[model samples]
Target chain A: MKSILLATTTFREAVRDRVFGLVAAFGLLLVLSTVIISPLTVGARGKIVTDIGLASISLFSLLMVLFVGSGMVHKEIDRRTIMTILSKPISRLDYLLGKYLGLWATLFVMMAAMTLIFACACALTEAEWKPTYLVALGMALCEMTVVTAVVVFFSSFTTPVLTSLFTLATFIVGHAIGDLERFAMVTGSAGMERAADISRFVLPNLDLFNVRNAVVHDLPVHSEHVVWAVVYALLYSAVLLAISDLLFRRREFK
Target chain B: MMTVLELRSVSKSYRSDFLFRRMPALTDVTFDVAAGETFAYLGHNGAGKTTTIKSLLGLIRVDAGNIRVFGHAPGTMAAKRRLGYLPENPYFYDHLTAREFLHLAARLNDMNRSDAKHRADQLLALVKMDHKANVRLRNFSKGMLQRVGLAQALIGDPELLVLDEPMGGLDPVGRYEVRRILEELKSRGKTLFMSSHILADVETLADRAAILNGGTLRRLVDLHELGHQERIMDLKFTQLSEAMVGELVRRGYPVERRAEAHHVLVEEHFAMAGLIDELVRSGSRLLRAAPHRVSLEEIFLREVERDVGQTPEDLLHRTVDELVGATSVKEESTP
Candidate 1:
């Protein structure tokens, strides 16, 4: 119950940032840019518009995770407000979960707004809504769930500059899980392969959540795939949050 | 009396730099706040006053000590539920209005919406913030924030209220208002463990106080005891002859012979009666006799400047013994 309260307040607070609004506006501009796509070839035009719109929604949400989500914990500590909140009957775990859920709410709103814009863009560009868009958008929120957890995890221990750097690095590595494996094999080093192997078990395969191509081509995305992706998102986010709670639990607010 | 808050051998150390050298923030601090008493935690800057309060509320873990609130370990849910806390230079969720913030605090205390709203209304009015209920906290002045902060601390109406520098940023009016609210809380049988460098307000509200110096417990002063301590009688009288004046000065009273009236400073109340009798017998007209009480400010300064090199164990035992003695004194003195 307390976690939900923290989440609501956090959502309200994050939404007040101008960076959040402008990022959404920029994503809209990117989505609406697809409206001017050449319509002579409907199949090619649909694929192009779908590709651009889904990516725009994904980009917008990631940006929200990057700028706004990274500061949730730090802001409270910097302002010394966490002293009162934690001094109350709330546990550190509850506080961390509230922060994660709060960012999720903000991302959900941003994704919803971007998806609505993408839908209009899809309609305008003759790239009619396939049920796949929801799957693709759902997967996008899922991917950001893991990424938001990453932001939250980093924000738990470090400054914003270091958090942003580490989160951006993690985002790159998460998406390149395939490349990491290939490089692990191509390089004949045993230690590199072992490290890659460990990361494979630890880092979320964010690549799996990218059904945008299948989504853009109007291909059928199996329900089992979405379910597994969600399972992965939930489990990965849990691990990150657990580790975050461990770090934050020991933190002394000096 | 029930012990509402207890800290035994509490110490905290911080990492100073990349070198990771440890600097003690609180060293062997020991004190207990009894239920229904306003216990002032006094110190100069860097004297670990906030560190001690944080340890009490479990905001920070102490390195080598134990703290309990209402018999529960510090920062436990059981502990937290029984107490409210306001930190130094309080900055709440500025994004929330005064009303919304109060509601949030109430809900966090596990109140349902309707109850939270009802309680928030009472608190808003109690803090005299009803007119600005909808006004955002970011728009509030420092004093306004302190007022609302106090009201928020009262939201749960917990058994104990731990406040850090509650009157630090307030104007005189704000200070008086907060002091009055704290006095009311005390009258209602609430335990208040407040930390402050501001001595004047502590003098008015605290029943007993513990002073810290360089992160060490230097003195635990029963203001009742401290108030009576070193109390002097300033006696004004007509000058006596040289022989009588020599007798008075030789007897250890400080006699200042002014042009119109002479003054004799009697060091103790027991000494005053005899000195006055002697002056009357010696053909001196007594003009006035006023009692001067030593303030907490003076004691606080002396405490911080005094080098207390006792070990943590010694400080702990001394605190417990002094507490027992003070309790007996209080019991004996109370009508």
Candidate 2:
């Protein structure tokens, strides 16, 4: 029960963080700007809007995960507040899970709000409001799950700066994972091959969850793909949070 | 009485960045805090006071030994349900109003919507922050933050209260209010285990205290024994003759003659009437007489200084031996 209250508190705290407000405003503006620029893209107005809208969700949501998630534990420790909270009957896992869910909730709200505006702009252009917006939103959520996991994992042992860098690096590699593998094969470098393989496994293939293209082109969406991506996200996030919980369990706040 | 909390042979160390080195923070420390007792865990800066509190709260795991709160492991759900904690230099979500934060805590403690609201109101009033309940925590002073933290800790009405430097940022009035609140809780039979550098506050509030140094429990100062019932008197009289001073000395009063007065030290067992009667009978004018009581700070500092190298268990063993000896003496006399 306390865990539930704690999760709510965590959500509120993350929501009010200055970074959240900044990203929300930025996303709102970026998605809104897509309306003015959509017609300039000639025959690709729908694609442009979808691209801008998806990019806004991806970028702003990642910002929230990286900035807010990395600082969750460190801020508590630095302010000596962890002592007060942890000294209660709450377990480390409860604290970690509560925080993860809290940030996820904030991301959900922010993404949903931005998607509404994105949809409105697309609808204004005689582009039908396809049900595929749900697909894009789902994929966006999956993207954040992986990003939040990476943030939580790095936050356990490293400083916020390092965690941000590592998470951002993972985001980049997760996107270009296919290219890295193909490059490794062509170069015939065993070390590079191993590095690429490890990167592919370690970094989530965010592109797999990139359903924006499917949404834009009006392609038939795969329910199996959604299930696989969701399962992958859940498994990946659980691993990251598990490692985070392990790290937090051993942290001595003095 | 059930032990509200206990740490058995607990040892904790931090791994150093410099390879293979572990800095021991607490070493084989063992103690039990009885239900409703205000046990003070004391130490200087860098002492294991915070470390011990952290371990008991399960903020950090001990390398060896075990700790139980309410008969359950420290980090377990059941154990946490009965606990409330106040950290030193508390920081809350600055954007949230005080009420919001406490409401959040109450909700987490599993209170229903209406119940959480009521508890939040009650706690804020208890902490004397009812007026500031709706104010954002960002604008609060340090004392306000500490008070809010106190309110938050009590959100669940925890059976076991753990306070880490609760008085750190409080002003004199705030400290007094906190002390009053603690006294109220103590009277209601709630256990409080706290660590603080504020020796005077600890002396005034704590029943028994354990001192920590260099990540070790050095000694537990028994407040009752160290508190003497004797009152020493500092006397000043105008032009007191030698005969009057001699009369005081004859009545078994230790007298030290200063520039124009005499100092009389009174032991607890010494009846004051005989000396007062004798002084009046001798016709010596009593200009001034003031009683001085033994302070807990002095005893705390003395024991802390004297037991510098002793482990926490060593001090506990010594106290146990003294108790055994005293009990046996009572038993022998009874026969």
- On lDDT, the candidate that comes out on top is 1
lDDT of candidate 1 at residue A163, scale 0 to 100: 92
Which lDDT tens digits does candidate 2 get at residues A88-134?
55677787787778778888887887777767767776456777778
- List ranges where model 2 is wrong by over 4 Å: A1-3, A18-46, A124-130, A188-193, A214-221, B16-20, B64-66, B227-293, B303-335
lDDT of 1 by residue, B295-333 (tens): 677667666756657553333223333422322211222
DockQ, 0 to 1 scale, candidate 1: 0.64
Candidate 1 residue lDDT tens string, A76-110: 99988999899889999999999989889988987
Query: Highest TM-score, which number?
Result: 1
TM-score of 2: 0.79
Predictions' DockQ, in order:
0.64, 0.47
TM-scores, in order shown?
A: 0.86, 0.79
**Model 1 TM-score?**
0.86
List the candidate 1 regions with Cα displacement exceeding 4 Å. A18-20, A35-46, B231-291, B307-335
**Candidate 1 — which pairs collide?**
none
